[model samples]
Target chain A: MSLPRHVIAPAIAVLAASGALLRRSRRRQRSRNPRPASTREWTRHPVGLVAGREIRQRLRSRSFSISVLITVVAVAAIIVIPSFHHTSALRVRVGVAPGTPSATSALITRDAHALGVVTTITSFPSVSALESALHRSVDLAVLSSQELLTYGGLGASGSSGSNFLTSLSLSLGQASALSAAHLSPSQLQTLQSAHPFRIVALHPPTPRRSVDPLALVGVIVMFMMVNQYAQWILLGVMEEKSSRVVEVLLSGLRPVEMIGGKVSGIGFVALLQGGLTIASALIASYAVGSPLVQTHASWTLAALILWFLLGYVFYSWVFAAVGSMVERIDQAQSLALPFSLPLFAGYIYSIFEASSTTVSTLYRALAYFPPTALFAMPTLVSRGDVGPLGFSVSVAIDLVTTVLVARLAAGIYRRAILHTGSRVRWGDVLRRGR
Target chain B: MPVLDISGLRRRFGDLVALDGLSFTVASGVVTGFLGPNGAGKTTTMRAIFGLVDLDEGDIRVDGHPVDAARRQRFGYMPEERGLYPTMKILDQVEYFGRLHGLSRADARSKGAEWLTRLGLEGREDAKVDELSHGNQQRVQLATALVHDPDILILDEPLSGLDPTGIDDIGAIIVERAREGRAVVFSSHQLDLVENLCDVVTIIDHGRVVAHGTVDELASAGQPRLTVRVEGDREGRWAASLPGVTVSEINGGEVRLVLEDHVDTDLVLSAARAAGRVTEFSLHRRRLSEVFRESLS
Candidate 1:
């Protein structure tokens, strides 16, 4: 489950580059008419060029930048806010008169420590000075031997403020009683240091919730990312078809190349966005010392990344074909809504299952269903509910299905793209093969 | 030898036949005008040549070989529905198409720039297609088609929606490409322009080629027509007594008469002379519009 991203990332890049270069070289050699030596040059890979255009356009778009920024900020807030609250609540500062007794100071420090708070004590010139420093320089102050002063009288019940006040008051009251008893310094020390009776539970409580935070988070990210990127492919193809640009493109490119280039171009953009989101989460988790990153994180992250890619490829082809059938944006949406049902079903089910301690039988079956597998399989991987064999089988099924889907989509796209009078019906196209 | 040969092209969209055994040859160094009414299968035939349309029955050949993807790369097409990437820069879009046709990046860029310049889109290479005027977008569409310097140009209504200057510029480019040894076949309803610009004309109706020949040949194919202009007669009242001499057109003092094959030219001349002093007399073929109308019928 732990992927070698560094090795795999660069290896995939090198392979893509090699394929492009090989295609260019082969195309050049295949040219029936060779130009003069001065004019001879290698043609670039068409899919790469098409993909490059998509990448450049998307990268430069305002919406893309804005979306990434928003995602990063939202992710940072989700991680950093809880940590900030926990650290702030445990910290307290106290002010006292200059001549305050050492024993009283020790009692205050000991009480705060027992309450699981970190206290900072400072001396002022007089009682007036100590009182004045309350809630400004310190949260609380010792105005006199008999009185304790706080700006808001210890905060609401069950808060860290109320807990600290209760502990400090009991310690101070005990010290005053001991002074009246005229106990010796050794006796006083022993009394103050005496241990409280331990209350042991007959039955220890276990955590009621067993959700895997990473899996839950992964499901949400995969759903949003896949849905978003798939829509882009749909819209892009719709633009080409509605504008009648496909005719010119088809004149020069095979339908397969066009669809392949389009999916690849947008897929890379989606990958970049997914990578950024993952990286941000990792960095923020590390910075805040969150326990969410501690359990099976590497493998879960790898699964999320792998599934995102498979999910995107599977949906993009289906969306692209739908795009080609309609000439208007509204028509595209209407047609795309039905095709998007599987994505929604998978997403909703994955989210529900990701939050449970145990995976359901239906969820496991859905992992093998190509459309829902994009969501269900990755969630299973993240939760450690699926083994390597299950994961591999799902991946293999998806890949084979993707190839078949791609062929079917390309065929439909080729046949229906040029029929402009009305939205092409899928049934008619399939039956007639027009 | 013909640069492009489309034979027995047939396509059916359900019950409607878009192309019915359409056959035609387009020779290099000649501009062939494809004439057809709406839904007469011109677009279908053109699309078939580029492999854009799957013909149920047809064979398209280029340079005596079957037209495949490689051969298609050497052909430029301007569809009846003009389209370009609205968000893409004109030069980049053109170059993208050129590269798609297998031109090197550098070559595509260079050629794209050259085509844009030739199409009078100079100084606007960076402008997006959506930012251009309708005529300018049309120019950009043509630039995409011509950027690869294709060997065969199949343009569907290339002259539609162009200003006179735009028309002349594009019309000249079409003729120039053909003169440079590229086979150019363009479909248009503008018969006058086609008649003036095309070297050969092919007229199709109901998806079949009804007439195919040189401009002069098709115009002169049927029975000869005699035109007579009388000094005093503003109408063709002089043809009343003449048999097998039917008036095809009469404008002012001139009368264009469609004569029977056995009709005597001397009798028509004597009849016109008897009515008024014969100022003009000549025999010539019908006009292209007339030929086109006749072929459709």
Candidate 2:
């Protein structure tokens, strides 16, 4: 998937020009309305200037635009391709042994219809003939007065077919027993239509284990986006430091302003790309009439975006601080390993937990922890396992932790950014006071 | 009043002391040349003035007030290691720095364009910084520092890697900025160039200011030297034997002599004329290189 040079060249030019124009307009507007001297004076501070530069530089970058385009294309493909594949009608083939009553064939067809699977039935003269027919074209086989054989084996278990087939076989067995007992048609009908015994519980029952495809997609997207964009913030900081551009910037701006502006700028770009990708996917799904849209809709989408933002904010500060401690890109990689451990743990844990109905106490606890909450809480929310109290608690914890981490990160960044060398240790940066 | 004043400044990087009680004053409307050997703390002093490096025990005052972020923003600083976003256009990069210095976007942009044009980078503003030649990139770096119309400009090694033309262009800009009543401070190893461009020279060695004065004041502190050129004597063989005069060199028809204290310079001039025919006789002020080398030693 490579684009032609001529196409890429013009596209790059247009993007760069538009970005420049947007930046120029914002700067002009800001200049036109200088804030009065007050606490709000920070609005016209150097932080905004630095952030504006970061945003303009990143938005116009070739890698950023290319990655965004790829994400949109991938999301569209995921939605549209599956819809095209499952568009045709689904049919199950049933083979009946010769002399097996026509009524049984009608029963199987009715059951399959009730389950929304169309049926094609065939009869043969002997059991061996029926077995051969089953092997040749049928999804399941019925031997006269004997057993139900499926592609899974001679038994009815483990076969990929409708539950209607299992119920039909059980009903047939009961019908045979009633006939042996010499029951009349009215008695048979009564037995066939009889309701089962019911068991009630004092508490609402937990839902059965089932995979929510939307939850799986949501968690995965959140994990990838948080990790990817956080790394971008780290790399951007490292580049500025190693290039010694930070020295010039620090001469005019405070360290806190520089770090704040950078993280916010990159974070905004991340949200834009993520939002565009998700929106394009939804549009594609709607165009293709994908069941995904019907299943997840807006709630899950909103949770995914919100959680992504929380996760990005939580991680980007840590990354930016770590980025400031290291003078080179390679040093950043080695130092980032510790910072990224929790993100990786949450990502892997959420993916494995997304489909399971019952989760461990550890997994539940992680839903409240800030580092993992971004990954864990979203899955729990999508599954309806999270209550209002739990959601609020998790959000509160995450918010508090983000503020603490941001302050800590700012402190470290302010101290270490000026001390360029092999790599500034965390302990050293923390120990050095303002 | 000095636009920038530093006193008792001290900075240590672990075991190495980069600055030791370093002090200097830069007044407006003059080019103050900051001269130092490598590792002599000229850069450290400049960075301290802008609060880039935290001082161990001293204060830097700008316009009679302690330096702060707002005051520093009014000062332009160019580090020894030039840094600019390589992928950004020349004009945009300049304007960005100007904005960082508190100029509005419109002001920064117009000022950026004006500086680029003034610095002979008019047509290359749209080119990426990396796309320009090394000298042109240096020009853009200068434009970034100057676009805000700073009250005080501190440039560290601004002419380290430029051709003669580039050096002259930058020197002219420094003089122009000073002429506009903005104090300009620049560091360079090229002593003669500094001597020609600066009204005052502050030479530091081993993290301390060894000498500080106007070029003439410093040069005339010691015994005066004289260069006497004779038309008839190609080797100047007749002038070496004069009393109280040491002939530093006799190249072709020119004789360079250092006069000791109380030596009659009239006798030396008469001796030069008596040797043959006097073509030129003039007092030779001490060159900045000689002063710098003397200070370092």
Candidate 2 lDDT over residue span A30-64, tens digit each: 46434324313443466677777878888988988
- Candidate 1: list runs displaced more than 4 Å: A1-43, A87-209, B230-242, B249-254, B273-279
TM-score of chain A of each: 0.70, 0.71
Which residue ranges in model 2 land beyond 4 Å of their true spot? A1-45, A77-113, A118-193, A199-207, A284-300, A325-327, A418-434, B228-282
Per-candidate DockQ values are 0.41, 0.37
Q: Mind giving the per-residue lDDT tens digits that candidate 2 earns over B1-297?
A: 697888888888778888889888999999999999989998878877866666788878987888876677678888888888877899999989987877777888999999999889988889998898889888888898888889999999898889999999999889999999999999999888899999999999878999999988988777778888988887767666777777666767667777889899888878877887788899987778767876776
* Best model number under DockQ: 1
> Is model 1 an incorrect, acceptable, medium or high docking prediction?
acceptable
TM-score of 1: 0.81
| Residue B77 lDDT in candidate 1 | 91
Tens-digit lDDT string for candidate 1 (B69-159): 7678788999999988889899999988888777777888999999889888899999998899989999999988898899999999998
